[model samples]
Target: MHLSLGFSPCPNDTFIFDAMVNNKIDTKGLTFDTQLEDVETLNRWALEGKLPITKLSFAVYLKVKEQYDLLNSGSALGRGCGPLLIAKRDIPRDEIKDLTIAIPGENTTANLLFSIAFPEAKKKKIMVFSDIENAVLNGEADAGVIIHENRFTYQLKGLVKLMDMGEFWEETTGSPIPLGGIFIRKDVPADVRAKVDTLIHESLQHAYRHYPQLSDYVKSHAQEMDEQVMRQHIDLYVNDFSLDLGTEGKAAVTSLMEAAQKLRN
Candidate 1:
């Protein structure tokens, strides 16, 4: 049976989900959807069980845990690769208040981080991650918190990166932030899923051997994204951290989830 898997178009997945691009891209008797979406869209599918295989945020999984089972936990967004806060070069951090801040997805990991860092920033709001640059360039927002491709594309439009949240998270937490993970439907055959998991694990190992080729992979999948941006995306989310999803990855997810849980309590 063909297994349908999905992943975002961001740089991190080149190491995890591709099938035909490399024999190394394992499907475990499954096939890939390669569906490019933000974490939010992916989560929606996971919730509905429409995603037999999907990349979803742990937070989203917590919301829809009843409907899914974890095949793996780890996203390309490392805890250290926090989102970028952008403003015009003229704006200073202390002066950032009373300014409209653009956010991407409501459920995105980055916006969650922003909330933790600035719980008192009463004036912030969200725009699509895709809309951030134009919003700032058009003055719709004083600053935009950019994620995903915008991290690389924003500078071209005169938006100044005011903060690197990924770096901030690393300095603050000493752990990689849990981003998203590969999930299989709750009812997927466990035996097949294990094979799938093994395939993904092995393929990632194969991909690691070709680390020098990652830039090329990132450019192909991520739309000519620069080497530095791609590397930052990888460094923040991948590396040894990618292979193991480590104790740190689990702890990071648990911490963030527990903190989010407090809002309900």
Candidate 2:
């Protein structure tokens, strides 16, 4: 069966999905008609339940939980690998409430974490993840929450780190930061979902064993990123958690959902 899959064009995602979509491994008769978008766009797609399989921010998953089931594989969850809040210059953390912030998306886990960290931050402008660094440098936004390769390049762009939201989450909850995960439509057959999960796990394992196979694919999607930066991005985001979200990872995702519910209440 053919299924529609949506994911970010970031290195980690392309690395995880390259083998499966390119037919490097057996997909159990399943073919993915894939769409690569930024994390925020994928979050918006999740809200509409548009794709049968897609990557979504863990926070966005909570809002559309009834429409999608979180798959155990292809997740970006680990320590020292969360979104960073950056500013053109160091701003007092306490003063962030009055400053307008640039977020990747309203539903992104970055924004959700920012909210949990600073509920007083009511002034926000949503921009594409890649545009946020420039937005801050150009004074379009006072601060920005950046994910993916931005964490590595922000300093070069003269951005100062205001906070590491992932570290804050770990310090508070004692669990790995739950960033994003692959989700499947709940309406798909249980067996098909299982196949997809297994296929994704296999794809990740294949990529790890043969990392060179995905290098080309990763570079093609990454913009203005050198080979080293792209490799760094993949290494940081993909790991044992990407292959399968075990006990700690699952608990982290559950915690995020529960916390989001409290925010709503």
Candidate 3:
């Protein structure tokens, strides 16, 4: 069976999901979509029951939480896995009020977290991850909500790391960043969904058991991706955080959402 697996170009997920499909361990194949536009695209398909499997960030999942049943809380942008809200380090975290902040995209978890932490901060629109560096350096925004490769590469860009949302959340509320997840469309056969979920968990076990080979795994997925950057990317988002959200990750999400509510003007 061809599993329509929709995902963003998140490094760890692209590699792990692809490896499982490539080896043809159980499923016949996959139709992989890496578009970073919005979860609405995937959610629309999911609402129509077009997928057997898909990934949705918590913010996205919130939009259709009842439409899909979670197979597992997975592929998280774990603790220390996401980018920092950098702003020349000398800038105090609480003093961010009235400052402009660059967000990689609208309606994203980064923005969600930004809403939670820096409600008074203004937003600057930038599409790609790396561009957040340029936006901040050029004073496009006092800070930026970054993700993906930029999380590991920003020090080279001279942005002072103000705070990693992941770190901040852990210290304050303690939870993994619920960045991404896998779920089954509500109407999919329970047995089929269970089988796929089992495969994913099993494959994850295999992926971690041989984590030493992950660099090579990353190389194959990201053709132009540097091994060091890949390693850094893996380090940032994949951790015990992935094994399960555990108590901490759940608290992080709840506190973030509560914080977001308070921040809403």
Candidate 4:
């Protein structure tokens, strides 16, 4: 059977899915028609129920939980791995609300976390995740909430972090930051979902077994990212949580969802 799958072109995602989608591991008669896009695009697609399986921000998951069930594997959750609020120069926390901040996406977990942090920060401009850092530097925005690989390179670009949203979340909730996860449509057969879940686990293990060696698949989609940055991206976003959102992982995700709901209310 074939299923439509959506995920980002980020190293962490490509690293986890390389084997399963490339047939390096046994898929148990399952084949995936992959759609590689940014997490925000995937999130929008998830809202539309456009793919049978896709990776989406945990913030987006809150809105589409009724239509999708998160798969056990292929999640991006870990401590010290949350989005960063960055600016070209030092910015006072008290002044955050008054600044025009650039956000990756309105539905992104980055924006959600930022909103939770600065509920009064009403001035926000939405842009692609990859462009946020540049936007801040170019004066298009006073600051920006950056995610994915940007966390590693922002400092080098002379951008100072106004806040680490992940750190704030950890301090406030005492849980790992839930970034993104693989979600399967609830309409998929239960048995098939289980198989897909197991296949994803196997796929991640396959990638892990070949660790320290960057695969062409991962490198190809990373655009012009340096090898070190790519490795940092994978190391930060992919971990035990990616293999499965075990108890602690699930709790973190639940905390994030609950927090988002409260913010909404």
Candidate 5:
């Protein structure tokens, strides 16, 4: 059976998915028609139930849990790897609420975490994650929340970190930040979902076996990203949690969902 899959083109994603999508691993008779998009686009598509399987921010998943079932594998959940709130110059934390900030997307985990950190910061500009650094530097936004490969490159661009959102989450909740996960539409057969989950796990294992060597697939879609930064992106986002959410991972996700709900209330 052919299933549609959607995930970001970031190095970590491309690295995890390259093996399965490239036919490097046996998909157990399942074939994937993949769509490579940014996380925000994937998040919006999830709202419409646009794919059989897709990667979306945990924030968006809470809004669509009824339409999809979270897969145990292929998740981007880990500690010390959270979105960074950055600015071109020093900005007092007390001043954050009054500044116009740039976010990658309203539905992104970065935006969700930012909301939790500063609920009073109501002025926000949504833009592609890659463009946020420039937005701050040009004074279009006083501060920006950045994720993905941007976390590795921001300081190089002379951006200063105002807060490490992941650190705040860990310090407060005592859990790893549940950034994003791969989910399958609930309508997909249970057996198929299970098979897809296993395939994803195996795919990552295959990538790990060849560890520290960047694949052409990962590098190709990384655009102009430096190879070193691309590796950092993978190291930070993909981990044991990517193979399986496990107990701690699931608890972290639950904590994130509960936090989001409290904000909604």
Candidate 6:
């Protein structure tokens, strides 16, 4: 049977999905019709439950848990891998609340972390993730919350990190921050979901063994194609948690969901 799968073009995603999508490993006779889009777009798509499988931020997952169940594998979860809030110039802590901030998306985990860290920061603008750094540099925004490769390249662009939201999470919760995860539609058969979950786990394993071969695919889609940054992205995101969330990972997600629900209330 064929399934529709959606994920971002980021290096970690490409690296995780390379093997399964490319037939490098056994797929259990399952075929995936893949769609690549930004995480927020994928998140919005999840609202409609259009794609059978897709990648979405933990914040988005909180909004659509009724329609989808997260798979254990292919998750971007770690301590240092959380989003960064940056400014073109160093903004004093007291002035941060007054600064106009740009966010990658309303439903992004970055935005959630930002809100949790600075709930008083009222003004927020949504823009494409790739454009956030330039938006701040061009003076369109006083600061921007950046995720993905921007975490590595922001300082190089003369932007200073006002806060590492991930660090805040680690300090407050003492658990790895769960950024994003893969989700399958609830309507999909239980066995099928298990198969897809296993496929993703195996696919990740295959990519690790054949890491070099996946570089071209990763570089082609990465926002910043620096080899060091790409490798850093992969190394930071794809970990034992990517293979399976295990105990700590699941607790992180639960904590995140509780926090997100509180934000809505």
As a TM-score, model 4 comes out at 0.99
Give the lDDT of residue 231 in candidate 5.
Answer: 88
TM-score between candidate 3 and the true structure: 0.80
lDDT of each: 0.68, 0.91, 0.63, 0.93, 0.94, 0.91
Q: Residue by residue across 95-200, what tens digits does model 1's lDDT show?
A: 6666778887666677777766666565766766788888888888888788766766777887788878667767777766666777778777888777766777
What are the runs in model 1 whose C-alpha is more than 4 Å off?
19-22, 25-28, 77-79, 89-98, 122-125, 153-156, 214-219, 226-232
Q: Order the candidate numbers by lDDT, best to worst.
A: 5, 4, 6, 2, 1, 3
Tens-digit per-residue lDDT, 1-265, candidate 2: 9999999888999999989999989999999899998878888877888999999999887688899999999999999998999998888989999999999999999999999999999999999898999999999999999998999999998789999999999899888999999999999999999999999999888888987444677788986898889889988999999988999889999998888888888
Clashes of each: 7, 0, 5, 0, 0, 0
Candidate 4 residues lying further than 4 Å off, grouped into runs, are none
TM-score of each: 0.83, 0.97, 0.80, 0.99, 0.99, 0.97
Q: Cα lDDT for residue 50, model 6?
A: 89
Ten-residue region with minimum lDDT total, candidate 4? 38-47
TM-score of 6: 0.97
Q: In lDDT terms, which candidate is top?
A: 5
Please provide, for model 5 over 134-190, each residue's C-alpha lDDT reduced to its tens digit, 9 standing for 90 to 100: 999999999999998888888989999999999999999999999999999999999
Kindly report which residue pairs in candidate 1 clash with one another.
3-30, 3-31, 79-177, 80-166, 81-166, 82-165, 82-166
| Least well predicted 10-residue stretch by lDDT in candidate 2 | 210-219
**Residue 176 lDDT, candidate 1, scale 0-100:** 68
Q: Residues 1-265, candidate 4, lDDT per residue (tens digit)?
A: 9999999999999999999999999999999999999888999888899999999999998789999999989999999999999998897899999999999998999999999999999999999999998998899999999998888889889999889999999999999999899999999999999999999999999999999899999999987899999998999999999999999999999999899999989
lDDT of 4: 0.93
Tens digits of per-residue lDDT, candidate 3, 52-83, equal: 57766555555556777766535565666654
